[model samples]
Target: MHEDIHVGGGLVTAFVAYALAAFVILIILRFAFARLRFSRYVANAPLAEAGLYVCVLALLIAFI
Candidate 1:
């Protein structure tokens, strides 16, 4: 079994850790996307970003 994340408050569950990691990655991805002018190419920028977030979240959960 996987270990829980130790935090100042307490231990966070594995799924929560995966979600937090994914969110951090999404933040970095947002900056890169903005620098690349990604929104200009997408028909629905927010929706695309949301999809990216879900993909990142899923990958994190599956791999780690």
Candidate 2:
């Protein structure tokens, strides 16, 4: 008999953790840029932040 199981649990969890960390780092970068008045040079910062948030949510879902 054969059983179906997933062996990538650790990988999935790691992906989730990495995504969360990336999200946090990106947020911090965005905040620092805004505070330093460099946001104008990087207008896509908000978009990148939003994309990272979405990626984090997706990774969490994937891990589950």
The top-ranked prediction according to lDDT is 1
- Candidate 1's displacement at residue 6, Å, is 5.1
Top TM-score prediction, candidate number:
1
Write the residue-wise lDDT of candidate 1 on 1-64 in tens digits: 3688788979978888777889999999999999999999999999999999999999887786
Badly placed stretches (over 4 Å) of model 2 are 1-12, 48-64
Cα lDDT over the full model 2 = 0.62
Q: In model 1, which regions exceed 4 Å deviation?
A: 6-11
C-alpha lDDT score of every prediction, in listed order: 0.90, 0.62
- The true-structure Cα RMSD of candidate 2 reads 8.6
Residue 48 Cα positional deviation in candidate 2, in Å, after optimal superposition: 5.4
Give the alpha carbon lDDT tens digit for every residue of 32-63 in model 2: 76788764666676776677678766755565
